[model samples]
Target: MKAEKKPIVSCKGITKVFGKDELAVHALRSIDLDIIEGDFATLAGPSGSGKTTLLNMIGALDHPTSGQVLIDGQPLSGMSKSQLSDLRLNKIGFIFQAYNLVPVLSARENVEFVLRLLKVEANERRTRADAALAEVGLRGLENRRPSALSGGQQQRVAIARALVARPRIVLADEPTANLDSTTTGELVDLMYRLNQESGTTFLIGTHDPRVMEHSKRHIEMTDGQIESDIRA
Candidate 1:
């Protein structure tokens, strides 16, 4: 029998509230979830259903108003701001709804941005960035700027940037939101392949059916609570 995988991230009774009583927004309410190792999971919900809020908390970009989040067995509540930053830099990769590439940089340079943040030497950064871009099927386009690339290609560059650092878990917030049906399908296949090939953990936030269909796990949220969680 195969050994059981450990949870990469675990949340307990999570609640995130913005502002104070009488003028407050409850983004998450009593959320208890775990993202297992090497899993491809999608958080499915409509707008204001708290998918992005939960993703943000899991990515360590923000803290929960109440409850505890543990990433790789380290609790977020007890960590300092700088510690959180380091955790994000070291353990997590992010692909935003809008491809967050710097317009001024070439595709290779954009992919190299993450490595540069870690103070990697210029030579090794170039090599890994090239490999990442090639892996994402953007070989000859390495020198192209974001403005010169199509939306799908731009998103590929973003994916290259995200994976170049070989993070423990990749957090995608509506990765297919900006893509067309065809591109969405293509991107989904690429992500699924990458997950299987590299055994990288993926936790995506999306309402798109196409995006959710390929995931190994599906979690639907409504009114700041999980409506259902099914693993296949």
Candidate 2:
């Protein structure tokens, strides 16, 4: 049999500078990074190290000042804003520290929102939303609103929303920042299970030791540049 090929995400000579010439703040400087599909990786850095800037570029939330970013061989520069939005909707999942759930929407509804946006059939949307909630251990609390749910449960709902579409990549920024250690561990374990079983790749940006411990590869940044990339 032929060897299995690695799916690639590459950033070539990427640079991002804010402000004008003399007062400019260089957030990322000529970053050359590659993350293969099915990889579990963490971006570890101190504040102002441009870890989030690099992630934002990868997530299509921001453009690089110079160079290029390629996802699955598609150049980001080749995409229009609408095309990027479509790509994000269909191919990327975002998990943020704040959970970002709709206050008025129930757990199931929040997950259903993404399905609806994807134009999933109404009936199938409900079914898939329920299943996604169940996968995140919120099966019995589907009717609860964000205010009624605990922080961990709310984050689980956010995770469900992210995973319901089965995106190829998950970009998580400080996802466990608000959780206790126990809940953080549970969340990490769940993500690992999903990654292993579904082959979903995770690219997490975190400063937490817990995240580093669970990551297969950890890339550390400092002063807006990659200081080291380590595989554990």
Candidate 3:
């Protein structure tokens, strides 16, 4: 097999502490991580093991108490909130356990939301939203509202929404939790194909065995520290 490419993201000696002094909680110990572009990697650990904390820091949703996070060689520490939001909007796609779609909006409209935020032309947004829905196998269902779609379909729409902006990184947090085994497999396969076709980097935080088995790289954490990093 070919060697992995240079890293698009690097985190060095990352540390996150909650509260302060005597009541402090060390959510994440010193951590060093490198994620290459197009890498489909999973962060696996039990609850409170710092997997989520690390992911949050990488996504710029939270800051570390010490150390630094770099995306495409740009340090995150000095970025303003607006700059961080701009980075997230342009470079990161997020998928959560909950299919957080608006009940009143159709799937197409939901996907169009991000493009709207970016001030994309209405016609172009419509075209891209439809294409994204079709990419996720939700073409005809694009007219349906979240309430009208099944759990799996709703998640697929959520995925379409995440990808509509064509962000560089996709951060998924327990995306399969609400899915059945079959649907879980389908979703994972879809994401894998997307990674191959679009070179979109995936950083998933999950405890599911299926996720661990399917990912190209697996990083295991324990007690707020990474125990192992392996590539298949």
Candidate 4:
């Protein structure tokens, strides 16, 4: 029998509460989940369902009020701020809905920014950035700035930026919110291909049916808790 694969990300009894006393708001409620490597999963729910909050917790951007998160089996609790920053830069990739690209930088430069932070050599950074852009079908647009690209193209640049580091996991929050139906389909297809070919895990927070349909696993959240988890 094949050995069981270890999860890339695991969350145990995660709960997040904002404010205190009467003003307290519960954002997550005793959530537990395991995201195995190469899995394409989507967190689907309406606004305020805590999908984005959960994503933030998993990405190490926010801490849970209770419980713990583990990335590649390393617990996040007790880590220093710099340590958490290192973990995010080295092990995780994030794609936001707004396509947070540097307006003045070219596509390649934006993709290379993380590499620079990691202190990779100039030549290697450029090579990896170029390769990532090409992989995302932005080969010739490498020199174009975000202002010069279309919405779909800008999002592709964001994907390349997120993937250029070759992280083990990618967290995307509403990645297709700004795109048209056709563009959304194409963007999700690109992400699906990346998951299949690179074995990188994806956990997306979205309400888009298009994204849910493309994902291999569907996790629905309601009232800050997981209502259903269905795997294909």
Candidate 5:
């Protein structure tokens, strides 16, 4: 890392445990990680490892039992509930394996959901949603609903929704898990292009070798601990 580059996501001595003592499950150990601006990084591990836990911590969806998470160099530990919500709204984008689109909403509507949450004017919302869907190669399909689209298309809609607000960082979890190889390849290519061309920081969590190989930084985890962290 260059001295001038600032970390967008920083985890210092982070740990997460579920339950107490005998029934306890350690989801993460004292992990230290930093994702700088414009990084395309991945967390790779089997189901039981701490990859998802760490991602949740970074996303502010879950709090760590110990230590600190800083977004844009601001510590999350001291933020109030509303403050955290605002931070997530303005600074982060999230994509899930299930392509969590509302079944009844059209692609454009789904994409516009974020902007609407921000209370953007209707005209601008429509314009931005159209542009975002087009950027994901879904130009003419904006009116289609989730059930009418294929898995990849649905995922693309989800991506469009996530990116419509222009968040500085994107956090995707097992984004290719539900797609076929061809679809996965296509989606990966699209995300790679977005990460490169848009300069949005991407931190993905997956066990797929394909995802790991495409990432510029790969971190492997095992039993709630980081096994290896390497930059390509």
Candidate 6:
């Protein structure tokens, strides 16, 4: 039998509140979850349902008002800012709906930016960046700037950038929001393939049915709490 996978992410009694007193908004209410290694999961809910807020908490982009989170067995609440930054760089990758890329940088440079920040040597960075771009099907577009690429290509570049460092987990927030139906399908398919091949855990926040369909697990939230969790 295959060895049982471990939980790569865990949350307990997570509560996130913004503001205070009368103006307070509860973004997450006592959330409890675990994402096993290599799981392809989607957090789905309508607007104001706290999907993004929960994703932010999981990605260590925001702090919860109460409770704790653990990534790769390390407690997030105990980490300092620098430690958190290091954790993000080494263990986690983030992909956003906006496809944040430097306008002046070509696709290869964009993918190499993370490696540069990690102090990777130029030669290795270039090799890894090129390999990542090719993995995402952007082999010949390495010199193209973001403006020259279509939305899907740009998103693929973002994926390449995220995967270049070989992060254990990838967090994507509404990654398909800017793409058309066909592109969205392709993007999710690519992500699924990557998860299958690389065993990279994926936790995506999206209301898109296409994204949900491609994920192996579905977690639906409402009023800052998980309403359902179904595994395919």
Q: lDDT winner among the candidates?
A: 4
TM-score of 5: 0.97
Model 2 C-alpha lDDT per residue in residues 137-191, reported as the tens digit of each score: 9989999999999999999999999999988789999999999999998999888
In terms of lDDT, model 5 sits at 0.93
- Writing each residue's lDDT as its tens digit, candidate 1 over 1-232 gives 9999889999999999999989999999999999999999999988999999999999999999999999999999988889998899899999999998999999999999999998899999999999999999999999999999999999999988988999999999999999999999999999999999999899999989998889899999998999999997
Q: Choose 3 or 4, whichever is better by TM-score.
A: 4
Per-residue lDDT of 1-232 in model 3, one digit per residue for the tens?
Answer: 9985877779999999999999999999999999999899999999999988998999999999999999888899989999999988988888989989988899999999999989999999999999999999987887898999999999999889889898878999999999999999999999888988898899999988987787999999998899999988
Q: Which ten residues in a row have the lowest lDDT in candidate 4?
A: 192-201
Candidate 1, poorest ten consecutive residues by summed lDDT = 77-86
Tens-digit lDDT track for model 4 on 1-232?
9889899999999999999999999999999999998889999999999999999999999999999999999999999999999999999999999999999899999999999999999999999999999999998999999999999999999999999998989999999999999999999999999998888889999999999988899999999999999998
Candidate 1, clashing residue pairs? Answer: none
- Ordered by lDDT, highest first, the candidates read 4, 1, 6, 5, 3, 2
* Order of the predicted models by TM-score, top scorer first: 4, 6, 1, 5, 2, 3
Q: For residues 1-232, write the lDDT of model 5, one tens digit per residue.
A: 6578899999999999999999999999999999989899999989989888999999999999999999998999979999999989999999999999998899999999999989999999999999999999999999999999999999999888888899979999999999999888888888999989999889999977788778999999999999999999
Task: Determine the backbone clash count of candidate 5.
Answer: 0
Please provide TM-scores, in order, for all candidate models, with all chains considered together: 0.97, 0.96, 0.95, 0.98, 0.97, 0.97
Comparing candidate 1 with candidate 2, which one achieves the higher TM-score? 1
lDDT of 1 at 3: 97
Error of 5 at 9 (Å): 0.4
Top of the candidates by TM-score: 4
Model 6 stretches with alpha carbons more than 4 Å out: none
Q: In angstroms, how far off is 20's CA in candidate 6? A: 0.5
Computed on alpha carbons, the lDDT of every model, listed in order, comes to 0.94, 0.91, 0.91, 0.95, 0.93, 0.93
Q: Please say which candidate is ahead in TM-score: 3 or 6.
A: 6
lDDT of 6 by residue, 1-232 (tens): 9999889899999999999999999989999999999899999988999988988888898898999999988889978989999999998999999999899999999999999989999999999999999999999999999999999999999999999898989999999999999999989999999999999899999989989988899999999999999999
